[model samples]
Target: MRGEGGTRRIVVIGGGIAGLATAALLARDGHSVDLVEARDAFGGRAGTWEQDGFRFDTGPSWYLMPDVFERFFGLLGTSAAAELDLRQLDPAYRVFFEPDSGPSGGTGSPPAPPSAAHAERDPIDISAQTATNVERFEAVEPGAGRALERYLASARDTYDVALRRFLYTSFTSISPFLHADVVRRAHRLVPLLLGSLERFVARRFREPRLRQILGYPAVFLGSSPDRAPSLYHLMSAMDLTGGVLYPQGGFGHLMDVLVRLARENGVRLHAHTAATEILTETDRGHRGRGRGRRARTTGVRVRDQTPGGGSERVLPADVLVSTADLHHSETTLLPRELQTYPESWWDRRTSGPGGVLVMLGVRGSLPELAHHSLFFTRDWPANFAAIAGGTVPDPASAYVCRPSATDASVAPAGHENLFILVPVPADPGLGHGGTDGGGDPAIESIAEAAIEQVSQWAGVPDLTERIVVRRTVGPADFAEDLGAWRGGILGPAHTLAQSAFFRAGNASKRVAGLYYAGAGTLPGIGLPMCLISAELVQQRLREALR
Candidate 1:
């Protein structure tokens, strides 16, 4: 992994998982690395915040794709299980639907019980096992269960071929797929790749409720089931196959271990330092002589804002890797003369929706709750339409994470730490609603509405009073604080045209010695993908140096 040039100096901007992971890998390869963060702490969106003796994780509650975390730690010659206590969750997550919303109780087909005798026994009663729970969700519609089994079988195949073979490959260009072996496999993938999750689910399940249940994961792609490709349904297979897991203590424990490994590997972390601009030096001779020439990055201008009034400093480096939002890095931070994309690019990028997050620390715990829960709105199609059309859903589907219910370490003796998230339309256009310049009051109003909705639906008595501490994050806040374009938390919308290789590449097409990672870059969003983004960049840097 060492570079051809001895001791290459690497500078990483934005100390999120992508930045930290990239710096760690580069440092482990004996490269001199410096990691900079705008906030006082690391972990970007995944960072933790504490108030009134209650601690809450700001973002990302569920831990899927456990092997990615393991691979990252393995790069540092360590095991994640050694530093973090990983626990697999049973029943994965609980899905709550409105009563009598459909013809059948909406649980989809239940998988076979672990024991053969149990499977033979009269439909094991979920209601008997857990009183408050609804009836056992074996498919009521004729042939629906068998259809689902077939659909899952196909999804498993997609995961084996696409996820392992194509999704993980580092495609510098489309040329690699032109190879015979790659082409043959890709030809089989075309139908699945172009197919929508909505169509796939509808083809399998006769009941609308079952279709909605299986189609839920498509939203993780930042699009609706009708819009997101069926290939993405491989996410469900990932969940049912590996099962969901959560690290004991909290997700922050895993972040802490990675940070420790990075520091131990000699990666310098400078927190509370915001990078204002990426400096570059153009070849003047070639420009004056009317010949095409490439420009080289000189360094970065970073502002230290801890002192109220900040002082700016320039740091030189051989290579620059930015894990910050792609649009932000291009338009706001880089020099105007060096801007690669147009203003309209930001508009298109921001058109994607953002979310309103409510982090609550509760006084008492609910015994009936699981580690993760999703409360689907009555009308799934309308809910997503509101989000995509730049309006809040009347009853938006909300996600809740009660980590303390699974592991007592997340809260004190008799409390629960709940992290709630509801996706909302971002500002219709950039530079409006005070977001382009700073925070927006209108966005705050939307978040307050979400809190009220959660109270009425979840049956939390004295919902506001039980909240020991509360924090709200909106698109405006994300745009200002995290430098996200239009405050998009998941980067560019995971639309069919923008997924995988179609996503912004890790290396800049216009600049030399520049690379990109994080939510905005290829492999897309989620903790696992962000870590892989770092690996891709590290691999490219090594090749470039060689």
Candidate 2:
């Protein structure tokens, strides 16, 4: 299917954010593209669901790194602002800390009786403006404003340097990391990359709350603060200075914009079409010619998922891109002999945490909660440990999103749309702790607990009673729906060893025309990373084609 300019037929598997973006870019570049999704929707993890006059974005609520989205739309000769109607959130979020029983320094002092000294712990409002948040920090702890400014300066530097020199580049080998820009900033970047975020925050701040605020963004990397590299503290700069923005509509609207972009670029997106196996032409078996070259993907064998669907059919292509789950694509779709990473290698890789998402359409509003809220339990460290250890933690730390609080269109009139996410180990065995090993019966109790906790924080004692609509997405759903590797919501963990240059590359080493562009690939996880990954894939494909 080569065209006038020798444009090759490209088959992009999985119509998620990365796939959608990549397909749009490729089609705009003159390739005949077909984007196939397994489910009946285009957005994979970022998919949306609506029921009883309420809508919910199934994944990825917080919109950080807005520049990436801008750049993407800019390349198409338009502005995301024109299309998305973006709005920056002021007082970005609210954080509620579990009341501390022990006195200052954990002196083991006797618990104070109900008195002025034992006041209720007030929730903190983190403003979008850095200076305002710093002031808030200072109010909470004396002299913290100055310390926060210093830390933010360093984070801004790291963010600036990394964005310019590292983020958009492919890192299949050490050559990319050895770039002149990277070398020039080695002194500043090297130490941060080597250090742990926990130590980095602790060294700069004394207050536990301040440390938690600084370290919490690492959760977006799908890792604990202690395990993630201090380099990711750059997220603080993105959140504080760059500002936490959201689409005028919910995230579902953002997805719709992307879909429109792809369609405008002439990408043929097919939902409910599952690619069963990747078709490849063996280069090694061609006697006496190109004997050493890796196998090249010619297309994919796809089958319609609708009822009474017919036999699988071959969709021929010159190049293929799989934006599906990395491990699942490699182990199941591609032939074992043609796989680059071995099963043992995948098994040893540290998978990120899966989350139990409890989405509720409540009958009334939550006045006390902000658009975004984080409830940090007193045992925050233990909570992280439990998730990493593949078990459920009691009184867990969770992130809650109330879109209706900001955009009333997401819910019925006078109602609220609530999304609560609790991180858990991505281990397949961890499903046994819940019901059916899919939606987990334990999720019911977990959701109940979350309602109670949020209700108390909102000063409403009976939040569960007002739940008119409810649903849950657990590890089992991830496995069944997204084909998540170990049911992880975020794909690979951003541990020091598995991050940046060490993350999966966009190009396939074992298959010449095969490429990967998704959260599982380099630049790491998050919507921004997925967008960046698409550009990386396009670059590699162009180089290979040349």
Candidate 3:
């Protein structure tokens, strides 16, 4: 660890993964760091809840890109394996598409006679190896095995190049990309950047089911594959190669680890504390607007969680990093004049859909369910379209996580932990709670419908009765909990226009000492991106300090 770099006082807003990581990094550099969070607990969206001997992780159940996490821990002079128990999921996840609509028959073999059980149940088990997934793909289309091998080969190259040259680049300036290493790869890079993931996959694969499977990872990027840039195809390669692992407890476990790590690094965390305003002062020499000098951030006005509380104190800081909701932090906490992105600019931006989550503690186990299951309908495109169009898709596809299947600690003996997620449009009005569009009933009604749909899919008609504990969170919760922009669960979509060079930056371009991190900033959303965003902010801070 380094000695005090003049003992800078740095205040970090939001106690999410990004905020915690940034605080820890800054503190490790011998800076005085204080992390303030509005929530009663740390972890922000990755929060967890417990009731009746059941523990449920609220957000981000899947753990992808293990290398990102390993690197983060390594930077702290430890290994993630020593701090946490992470196990690779054998069948990474199970995707159940509409029967016959997906690949059910084996390649070069007679279509397997559908038994009554097989007729009712059909799912492609995705494994860690590309060969295993290719075999499953071959079951649907005769020649798909070879095609997948080829596609993955190309995707691997892109992933490697991106990991080396793109993902870590802060994009704070253009000089980084002007290097000979990046210029040499222009032929491979340009095409990936120019096309959409859907088009790219369709050009390589023929079956609709195969194409959907290949492109589905884009959902994590906050856009349908059709809208996401092909550059994100790297996700498929990363997942297939890096493998999906699960922390012993859940994704929440990682947050707990981060909180402890941050504290160990001398970062103080203030829960239930909200930042109201960013205080700034112009440099003395360039004062009075005579010079076109931007103001520098100095501190934040905060209020503790109290009834009708006003600003309780001004926490002075040499630098401020906000990992809170980008839209809320910029438009609400900072003065309009100080904000580079205006309200109108935010209005013009397209955010990813928020989620309606159902957490159930069932009395009995579901032997048929996998640890991670994705239930898709015949017309998945319609579901995507409905969400993109600002409406909840009727019979929307759902993702179900039964963590109890793998880890007995999350639920009581013989009980199952069911976490179901359905994507809803990120309409600002929707977060206010309503029933205005497409059989869009009240939030509770939607929960009932979603529950019913999942119960049917799980083939447990009595699934509702088996639920000993149940809780639901709609868009309204996202708005209240995370102060998310339009209640978007993820951040901005990875559409061509909203991707790198166009996505939000780590530093406030117009304000000195004001920086940003989290899903909304550079490298975009997901836990891995949040970690990367923290490093990006650290890089910016180091550069400025120097």
Candidate 4:
């Protein structure tokens, strides 16, 4: 660790994964760190809630990238696995597709005869009651599972070379790629970048349902399968190889461990504290020279609303790291003149859509359910088209996480904790301020439709009646609560242009002593990337201080 003489005083805005990770790292390195979060608690969007003795993780049920979590705790000379019970789920998750209808109007397609290829193998039918449909699913696409395995194998290679070697590298400038070491690796990454995920999968499998199931993750990045880069196939590899995991207790347990690590290392966390303004002192003489103009962030004005919404206080700091939504921090927090990017630049930065989440506590356990389940829409292309067109899809594919299936601590003795999410277009009709087009009814209707669809797929009778408690979150609420620009769940879309160096720089182009980490910045979304973004910012800040 370095001495405190040159130690930078840092304040991080937004206590999301990025903010907390940054604070922990900086503090571990002997820097003075204070984390001011707008929310009443830390964890930002991934926070949790407890109601009537049942606990729920409000956002991000899937915990991928175990390495990111390990690296985060490594900075504090500990490991996340030591504190958190992260169990790798077997059979990863189940995918539910609409039961096939026969030639004219039957419930399912024609049943398939047992294939010689897997005569001795045990068939895994997620939709068991729809046995006839499962056989039809196999019949429609012979060797569909085998093709998926092959696709995943190739994707695993891409993950090894692209994500492990390239994505994590902090490219302060593009000049490094011109080096021979990087040049050699470019060949592998280039092909994947140029190709489309849809085409890549189509070349291997002929089944429409299997194609939809395999290609769905790309939509999380807001890119159509036909448009998304083939490199995105690495996402599937992560799930297939690493396996989806959930922390014991809940996702918030991970947050709690992080907070403890930060506090132990001398990082100060101010919950219920909102940073209203950023105070910067810039060298006027160096303005507009396209050169060095050293600036120091003197302090932040925080509004403490804990005690009847009282006055503000100025907390001093030498540097500032913002893990809040990059667009929100740039457009709303900083002075207009200090925002280097124009409206057009921001307008072109197309963030992906927000999510409609349904948190439910069921009265009794559902034995057939898995820890994670995905109910894909029948027409995925149309659903995506609606989102791209800035309208909520009439029928959206949905995902459900039943943590209680694996961990008993989430709910009471015999109850279950269910979290369902459906991605919808950002509200307010795109060009206008983000607002749900049809308001509460529209969002609720989407949830209701999803519940009905999921219930049918799961073969549950009167599923809605079993719900003991329920809470719904819409796009508007996400925007207001998280300061998301368009209520986007995963930050800007990870299109080819928006990814890598194209993402907003970790440090502001206009503001000195200001840095960014989290989904809205570099390395993109998910817990792993967000943590890496914080590390990248820490490296940049360390170099600047030197």
Instruction: Give all TM-scores, in the order shown.
Output: 0.87, 0.94, 0.92, 0.88
In model 4, the Cα lDDT at residue 419 comes to: 86
lDDT of 4 by residue, 1-546 (tens): 234678978899999888998999988888989999987889998899888778989887878777777877787798876888888776577777655422311112223343422321212223322233335345657766556656767777767666555566566766646756557768777888888887777777655555665677786665678767888888876665566777898889888888888899899999989989888787564556564434546778889868687679998877888898888887877877677554567888777877788888888877656888877655666777778778777667788889998888889988988888888887733221112223477676777787787777788877889888777788778788888878877788878787777777777766678888998777887788888988888789778877
Model 2, residue 338: C-alpha shift (Å): 0.8
Residue-wise lDDT of candidate 2 within 1-546, one digit each (tens)? Answer: 566776889999998899999999998888999999988888889988888898999998888888888898887778887888777787689888776544431211233334423333678888888889889878766788998898888888888878887888886567756778778878878888899998888787766666788888888898888899999888889877766888878877888888999999999988889999999887654444332336878889999987787567899999999999999888999877778765777978888898888888888768888899998876567788888877887878889998887787899998999999988778555452222223556766667778788888667787878888888877878887899999899988899888988887777767778888898888889999999999888888777667
Question: Which ten-residue region of model 2 has the weakest summed lDDT?
Answer: 104-113
Q: Global lDDT of each model? A: 0.70, 0.82, 0.81, 0.75
Model 1 clashing residue pairs (backbone):
none
lDDT of 3 by residue, 1-546 (tens): 123646689999999999999999888877999999987889988999898999999999888877888888888888888988988886888877654333332111223343433543566778888778888777766788888888888788877777777778777568757878779878878888989888898777766556767788889988987788898888888666556788998878889999999999999999889998989987554546432437887899999875565548999988999999999989999887778777988888888988887788898879767899887765666788899888888877788999998898999998999988888898645533322222234565667777787777767789988888877777877887789988888988888888888888777756688999999988888998899889888878777778
Better of 1 and 3 by lDDT: 3
Q: Which number leads on TM-score?
A: 2
Q: TM-score of predicted model 3?
A: 0.92
Task: Using lDDT, rank the candidates from best to worst.
Answer: 2, 3, 4, 1
* Selected candidate, larger lDDT, 3 vs 4: 3
**Regions of candidate 3 where Cα sits further than 4 Å from its true position:** 1-5, 99-121, 284-293, 306-311, 431-441
* lDDT by residue for model 1 (263-337), tens: 999999999888888877774433443323356666789999786859999988778899988887887777555
